[model samples]
Target: MKKDQNDRDSAIIIPFPGLKDRYYEKGISSLESHHFQEAVDFLKQAYQMDSTDPHISAAYLAALYENGNYDDSKRMAEELLKSGIGSFYDVLDIYLMILIQLNDYKQVVATLKPLFEENEIPPEKAEHFLQLLKLSEKAVRNQVMENSPKDDIPFLHQEQSPQDQLIGLGMLKDKNIHPYLDSLIEMLSVEKVHPFIKTAILSLFKENKIDQSILVEKLGKKETLNPMDIPSAEEFPFFHLVKNQMESQLRDHNPVLLEQILDMIERHSLCLYPFEWEPTNPSVWTAAYRAMGYELYGENWNLEKLAEFHSVQEAELGTIFTFIVKLEEISSAIVSPQ
Candidate 1:
């Protein structure tokens, strides 16, 4: 439960730790030594201390590019150039370096042509800049970044989220959501789409109070969703409904048992998200409580008592419990111990 909660909260950006004056020398030294990670770690703090300091910003930008944080480097470079952090020429050079590394040759060609035409380039660096412009022109001529078959994966969680589809979802936030409904529906219909991406789509729909009908599928289950009526992530299905039912059964009698059961519900919710344990029966998870209580805690959670309380047949509950054990195992594998 705690681990899953933390994952949901990971979206909040964490800035670099504070640094005192003169500490950026440490970062400069790291950059000189080619220890890119150490350089980013140290210089970002110095950059935070005084973003106006061109020397610190330039070193940090170099570190980020070398560390393969092209997105961060790209953003920093754009800011420096747009705002004239110190000198337009100096920042423009770093910005071009980042764009080349990202293979955004189109942007490189677009940016440099104007600069060269206006005689903006320094004589000493003009030849070097011209070579980059020609290189990018070649790639752009080949139509790179234009005819790519897949979406551009975001820099955040690029290892797991290899495609940039999530950016589409982010764009939908606070929008009408009607114009893009067809695009979203098509994305969901593709079988190759990742579960995490699909979850983000539905969660966004639910968050924005969407009223449209959309088809949703998982494992082998399929349903038409009207997200306006369902629970959002804040009021997650299990935590909203089944949790109250289970608590009613316990009647505040055993804090330890209640805690253990809530943990199971949270784990199951995390494992099965964008979906929840359904039929929303108190008996199903009440039965889970009875079984896991025995298996994990060595307590005799009477099956007959649980069945009687929930007004379900013991035989049927046992059958459901049989599948629950397998489901529980799969759920455990997804939520590794933190």
Candidate 2:
């Protein structure tokens, strides 16, 4: 059984039994040559042949991210972290670069918090994270100011202890948590929160908090969405999964293709498709449709289009929603076809 599994796991080649050292060297060489995809494939083979090859797996993850295999890359990174090996820190260091490109600040913060808690970070490494956190803090603030300020509050982790809170809050406050501003108010409301922390948070919130009723009126309150309707990232498909499906739909535009796309939108609880329609590559038409907010997640949709499509039947929404479900379900079924 062991021999059969090993044979099955080995990378196929003309000779049928490729030397492990040769494949490992080739993968490293491919990475140096900037052949990211080829390097990923070869490194993956080396990984399978010897799961102990920590360096190979790290290199594979780098190549995977560079080659735009974000899902696999992320999975590999997470697997390394969870596998309880010292090498995962090295993998995470490289994975952070990809997260930066994806604008995934929340994940970066989450990943950083663990290392901070463990006090495992060196000064040079700590400085790099600090710089990234600064950029992320600014980006998040701009996003809130330009768009939905209320929505951004959810990204704040209320469960964090005072020490963990200080590191993240310091980043959020841009290193000057002084003089108390309205921004910190929401941070104070939690029960059992430290008095010092509460004082700091209360000062910020009091400064920023406007009259809720008046603000709502000024914003033109109509039918407000239930807070329960908000979609969390954890509840949706991985961003790359939606991106892959949307790209597939774009590559072939027909009613059948459109149906496939709509199916994907519906299945992922209407969240994944929103980001999917808007990819990193703007040259693709999917980005245009996504930018138009055709398949926005629960909310954060463009107002003009929302009005135009508001009266559109809920059944259509159901159809699209189920299409996504069907896509996931069907794909899984096929993989384990009965």
Candidate 3:
């Protein structure tokens, strides 16, 4: 659509059918050689002659992108996508990359959301799409917060409904949260606030590298935390440490046992999160999860083997596993998905 492109077209002689193939071959070679402008020139002619050819259209889109013609790249990609001229996902990916290069992050977020909700992303491409979704969302959130009239900190107050607080906290990610730090820490101290909300606040603080040392009170226990040095609130080590040890032990063989134990640990994570539980003895819990995993599969559940595998004493592993089972019974309601 440039004046030069139009001028080039005006000077072109009428081409026979075979000429388009020659143009395509040269265009693809130019693209591979990083001669983007030449690629664009040749591919544009090929695409104009055979717009229905998916291969030409795809190559033309790439050429336009490499030529730094993001607007035309996006337009061509969308047209190809709408006409079903190429692989749907491939065209979609090209369209998204164009949006990203143009810094049209809001559009990027809007485009990806439905694909995720409908489970339409191919399994092989899911990770790439998820990463794009996260990146765009952060960019969009920062932009929205920059233009907003008020910060979302007020939503963390005790009087607000948990749903509203959660909504507000969701808005707070990737922003300069320093102004809200005191309020966030105070919310953590308040016993009446939803435990889930408190956890979210702590996570936000931790992610932004809060510089101040602070006292955190949750589930009736108090600990002084330096936000920069600590894990994200959801990433508390007790929940993950046992799983890590199990991976070290059962990874080469008995992967089934390792996976089952990790699931058991995840269930416990859901139950105990934002609760004050810390693993003073990770070996005991690791052994406990292993025992329960073996029991569930009707496999041999030898106490000695479990303790030795986990480097915990046999009698102590038995005793603590009993206690953990009892703890899980009372905490069962917390892990229900809904």
Per lDDT, the best of the predicted structures is 3
Task: Tell me the whole-model lDDT of each prediction, alpha carbons only.
Answer: 0.65, 0.50, 0.72
Error of 3 at 225 (Å): 1.5
Native-to-model Cα distance after best TM-score fit, residue 280 in candidate 3, in Å: 4.1
Q: Give a tens-digit lDDT track for model 1, residues 1-338.
A: 35686676896755445453455877766665456899899888788778888888888888998788989999988988887776677677768767766667789889999989999898866865776676567556645333432333121223333123443344334545555555566655455565556667777677766787878775456778777866655467455576677677665776556656666766556435656665566666676666776777766677788788668888777866776676577556433311
Whole-model lDDT, candidate 1? 0.65
- In candidate 2, what are the lDDT values of residues 42-149, reduced to their tens digit? 888888787766766777777888788877878778888788544655677756656655657777877787777888777656755655555456556555433445
Which predicted model would earn the best TM-score? Answer: 3
- Model 1's number of clashes is 1
Scanning candidate 3 in windows of ten residues, the lowest lDDT window is 329-338
**lDDT leaderboard ranking:** 3, 1, 2
Candidate 2 Cα deviation (angstroms), residue 121: 1.4
Q: List the residue pairs that clash in candidate 1.
A: 153-164
Which 10 consecutive residues of model 1 have the lowest summed lDDT?
153-162
